[model samples]
Target chain A: MHKDRLVAVAFTLWAVLVTGAFLQANGAYLFGKLLERLGR
Target chain B: MLAFAVTAALILALAGLGRPLAWRLGTCRNGQHLTEAELWALAPLLGALPLAVLVQVVGAWRYDPLSMAVTLAVALLPALAFLRLRPFVPVLPWWPWGWMLAVLVGLMAVSALAPPLDHDSIRYHLTLPRRDLELGRIGLWFGWSIYEFFPPLTALLTRLAYALGGAAAAQMLNVFWVVMAALWAGLLARRLGLGPQGAMAAALLFVSQRVVLNLGAAVTTDIPLAAFIGAFAAVAVAGTEGARRALLLGLLLGAAMATKYQGIVAAVAMMTPLAVLALLRRRGLPALILAGSVALLVLSPILLRNFWITGNPVFPTAHPLFGADNLDIFAPFTQAMAARSVVPGGLAALPWTMFILQDAFDGLQFGFPILLLGLPFAFFRHQGGRALCLVGIVIYTLVWWGAMPHLLRFLQPIFVPLAALAAAGLVEVAVVGRRIGWFRPVFAASVGVAIGIQALFAGSSALYRLPVALGLADIRSALEVPAFQYYGLITPCLWLQDNLRPGERYVAVINDPSVYCPQAPTLHPLGAGEAARFYSRGGLPALSAAQVAEMLRGGNVRYVLVANNPGTDDETYAFAKHRFDAVLLPILRQQKPLVDSASGKIYDALAVLAALESGIGAAEPASGR
Candidate 1:
């Protein structure tokens, strides 16, 4: 049970890094578009 | 509205017939059974798609609604007879199902409702068949359709659709394939022993990807090929050994290969597993041979056709074997293709580059963040089935990273397994939630946020042309960014259709000659490819405008529509802009405009006819000759 908990915690942490990077990377494009829309 | 409705009915009927047929062909063995839902999922490629491509091929020399309809009926009737023999199963439950269905129908209705505006579809998928329909045959040898040398799987079906109703009918084929891909996603997740929710999540991830949503409505073979990859994965997970599994896997692989060249990537990915399995069971040699034989047989006709015409099975690739006359033309192209801008930081940065950086070359990227989020969970434990789905994903990803890392569409086939694994991750999150109290809401919040974000991006973009689908508009004026650019270009084609002289043909120097000039037989001529191959072989002399036009005229290529700029099609060759300038500069100046506008110059081919009549027709074409 403890090991499963540990694995889950590791997974959550890993996911956080990936999700953060993805959102940040994806946001560059999204932000550009939002700005374009705003400017329009 | 009526056009959309009628075309929808026609494609649904065709796809309906295909489902039963696919079930009959794919599961015909001892102890082999599949539910209706499963059959529906797999049938598009296994049963119906082959039939569709075959109908177009056999009826190539003489294709029309009457002939094609008869051919389709011949294929569908037999499959319809097998419908009652298959076992039935229901679709997995809601959340995913409801979301998937909504997204699928939304995409279908949008794609079907709008005219086919995908630049590639306009250029070839719809264009090749439209040209063949004009020529009254499959007519690959003569017509320098550039696309004809490649596989005809996507074109043939779209051609059938074009013949039946119009562009809308052909667009529905893409829609049906997208839906099939979604179904396969569910089945692949289920095969991985994910629960119904997990299955739904898998499928949802597939449809949710912004690229899939954008591409779902657009006619392309990437998604269809991806669907086949999923089908192949599901078959691999079936725990079968020996000839049956090999045959099924081969069939799926062949279907993938037929759809796009990327199928070779998929073929290798799936073949590795089969090879390992065969070795373990001591059936390695025979199994490999069977699989190889089937794929070769499927591809043989195309290869043979290519060999027959160009003396090369793949065409333009084996310049040395076939005589290295075209080195200059092909060398740079080969180098340019091989020299893809390495995603900076190589494989380590691939995750961020693929998933995060949305604006890679040509605004193409498909790795949804949720997929990344959920992927780790798929590896938490051994998935269901004797076959390792993870191995297939790893193989496919490695191959993608090795060969073509940056190009998303080429790597799209891996999406099937990737989406399923992501779903498994989500399910794992739920498992973790069950263990840890506070983690439960975190998982739920993540799910809610992930789904919300994906839906917002994918759904909004997909619905851009929904008004056209809803019968509220006439022509596509409100298309999203890239597609909207195509609206003005179709005007010249429409104008040409109305104004052109009978038996007067055209060659589109513009990017997509097919879309612009659908009324008459128009050819893009792929001047860059022609020039490259022509100039590559050193002996080929600088052919004059008269000489070039005369050479093209041998295949009944007459008038050429030289675009002011490259029209809306994806860039096939880097030096495409130089084709007309280098080869036919004088024709642009000397030939009188049949209908010269801002779109491009439509030069009369009668000059070539005149040159021939005057006996100035120079040396024949050395390339596609």
Candidate 2:
């Protein structure tokens, strides 16, 4: 149970960081559209 | 409070209006069953709607817009980053424990030496922060501020290393909290049995720009409370065998409750979910044990302390419970509830809309846009996760809407669980990647890249923005600015130990009172006078003018600081001009200018006091205590 839990946690950390990295590389355009609304 | 009203109205409107649009556009869908990673990543933005509404309402009432704006901006920026990342990717690479340990250590190190920019730290948060930095134990009668009388669990642990070793030894306390927060986030993820991807996503959300930048480094009670809340939630999720965990969880929950009053809300929210589950499972004994232990462990001390202090278990808060006369806590609530007949000005409406826009995209300052995504997901049946997340959101939203004192730090406890669910929802959506071929992958990749970029920029901007805004260009320039000096003088607080003689006290009679120059006398209680009181706790009473006049007929205040541009209604100026002319400042000679602004000058008060002490005045006054 403990090992399984650890595995889950380990995977989650990786997924989050990878997701963050992906967002860093490619998600800026969509996010930028959101930011443009701020000019109002 | 008109600001609060329009804000609350707008929030209800936005949530009502936007969720459907977001869903219809498929913006609500992120992936699949939330990984532990995603849960941790997205927990902070739970209270976005309520907070944005509250800020707008507060803004509408004509409170200082800049600080309000700054607070909202700071809090929402992280939410935006997360929201941007939600669609395309939801998780990261899972490192081994060894790698995680090293990374945690590095993050912790960065947290400590980073210049303490959190204003509340020196004022209240770090009165305990600094005290914990020095003495590991929560000392008694810490006269710094009344706010320091919070749950000392976090303070005790943070200061323990410093106290056992030496002063400045526990500079790594911030690092400890950062690591602990990450560790706890991991624990929470594991407890939820999230997949590798889910857990990583959760972890990222937890360490997202919002959590790390805002709560990690700042020595405040918020992170600790959030930590305990997560711990309690984790234990409560451990199932039938976890009945044993109840008492322990109760203790931590109690400690969480003690950290801040909002901890009470979290405790209730967490426990309620557990109780309902136990009931549904027909585990009567475990349910009883859990409920009883929690009440006994948590409520007993709180009730005892409350009764001891204010004759009620909840001595401080009187509204909706037995009414208490403490206006400080309840006044904002009452004022916000009271409807003003006059319409708020047009300028007021401007910020109202701006905060709404900011909060929608930015998560009200921490930048967790994923929160905007998560609320729709709350309608789905993940039972445990959904229930917990909903409870947290409701509590946070209610608190924000009902009583907005306009302090973001107050809302810290609400963020943890909210972030958890938002991350979960994001991951849940990301899991849909298998269905939509090109669309899924494209969306997932774009989101991940977007959030990552936004986080980098947001973090950099947030890190640099305050210092730049405060005009902290250089050491000399910083010191020359009173505001900058206030932030820069953490080390100077330690300097008083070596610089001053044991018996001699320095009194600065500055017309303008500042946080940096706390040894000065003025109407603003938190100024220099409060600092002197903190240093001289239980030792010497620095004589206010009325008190000084009764003793020595007008001598012995030893020093006076006369600052330029000490604005109108400066109590010191009035005293100097009218009442104190005869007794004080007999030899008022100018010294080197302290601040660069037109309103800056340092005066030598010892010489003046010395002359006064030597029979320069006729009034033979009695000595005062």
Candidate 3:
């Protein structure tokens, strides 16, 4: 159980990091509409 | 050639971009080198995706903004990841990915050489793609038009194929899904308590069969539907907390739902397991959150689309809880048609023996008879497994009851779990073989024979082709490759681009316009039985038989290709015969034949366009003038 939780935490952190990077780089293209609205 | 070149470049570029990310993911998961088995398991799945560059590139010919974006994401991400992962792993298994790839590529080649055999796809799937290529935009869809409402995921791939691979790009797309399905099956097997080898065996068994042959190599929705549903199920199982996984599950579920209405059932079915876990497990709040969030998230986009178009979130099926009727008297009444309905005599009307035999135990032309073998054992073994199997059976029973005289496509979701259960049974057999020394040889021989029988059946059906053996000899023939041809949604669209003329308008009278014209000149989907919208005001619905005849008289409709063949009343055939002669005779006579096969026929571009534009009345004068 402890190992599984640790694995889950690691997976989550990795998912967030990768997703964040993708959002930052390609964010302009992928989420342009939402971002523009947010800026407003 | 031009389209194929461009598509290849785009795929390579996107793959390049994704490699870093894919590598990052792999590194994060296990780090450094991969085991022989992991390499083997991973190889086939990755190689199977990002399939023929021609298919994806061909879609650019039409350039649907929405579909293009999604394709770029799916294609590039995986391609890049594979490239990155390969370099990181030093030693890999010879038998794992290597053999799997050999068989898969072989199947693809063989199926390509075989004739297109999807009954409905040829009737309309290829028909639409052919039209899309010929026509720049699709106008309207009607008459056996249920196909139009399907999600754009597969069509986008087909459009890419049409852009890159010319007409046969759908074949490449099929190879892609065959890989996706295999990967998902492997994942599902792991979840069901199978080793890597066992999972591979199950994946190969499911992918390299006759039933898979029909959908995997052709442009059909069944395999994609199955893939999405199974993926959703896997995700649902993976989620530890109810809330966390539920949210993810919802998104996946929604994506599946958007793919097809049948996915709604699959989404619900998948949720049932999570719900059970929530009830049984201590972390009920998290489970509930996960399940509910996922369901809502996944269902929202389609629900919103439905609500926006049909004035009800469910659309075309049921009225919204707080909404008024979305129809008026003038529109065609489409309310009573059910997605699943009961016909009198049901299975009795079908060839009961053949149906039972095929459903219970499919051989070469189909999958192994897992349901019969697994259900009995499931009852005696794991309670949870038995419960899951029962739920699946109930769902299938309801679906079958409602969808009497249904096609094989309708049974996909049920099959996913059935395959898992069957894999469990096979694992048991392997264990039993290990226990008894003498039985080991017999078991191995039996497995060999079973595989041989399946291969022979699959080969005889011309569903797919097997690869050349690694060793050249009569005995080594067992190592033949497996080729696939089904492209899920892309098949019809690819056919359209290859056969049809560029810059023509082919009106598809269906909600899912991709069914007829993947890249039509003027695509006007009738969302949520919005038939009246087309009929009202300046919509294409005004282009009725009389209107079409008038357009033909004006030399507007040069060619008319209707895919509502064989299945419908003789009225449609009679309608085409009378109208084409009375209205489009001159144009038909003058126009070049676009496509003529067992599927349908296409005609000259100018004639059909002219007929559509000028109305049927100006047949001689409009052209001459």
Best by DockQ: 1
If you score just chain A, what TM-score does every candidate get?
0.61, 0.62, 0.68
All models, DockQ values? Answer: 0.57, 0.03, 0.01
For candidate 2, write residues B432-535 as lDDT tens digits: 44444444655455455536544554444344433433344432343444454423343332233334443334443333223343332222223333332222
Evaluate candidate 1 and give its CAPRI docking class based on DockQ.
medium
Give the C-alpha miss distance for residue B415 in model 1, angstroms. Answer: 1.1
Ranking by DockQ: 1, 2, 3
C-alpha positional error of residue B466 in candidate 1 after TM-score superposition, expressed in Å: 2.6
Off by over 4 Å in 3: A1-40, B1-101, B109-117, B126-144, B242-244, B310-355, B359-371, B378-397, B403-405, B437-449, B461-530, B533-549, B559-625
The best candidate by lDDT is 1
Native contacts recovered, each model: 0.53, 0.00, 0.00
lDDT of 1 by residue, B478-497 (tens): 43245344333554566667
Fnat of model 1, as a fraction:
0.53
Q: Looking at candidate 3, what is the lDDT of residue B554?
A: 48
Pitting candidate 1 against candidate 2, the one with the higher TM-score is: 1
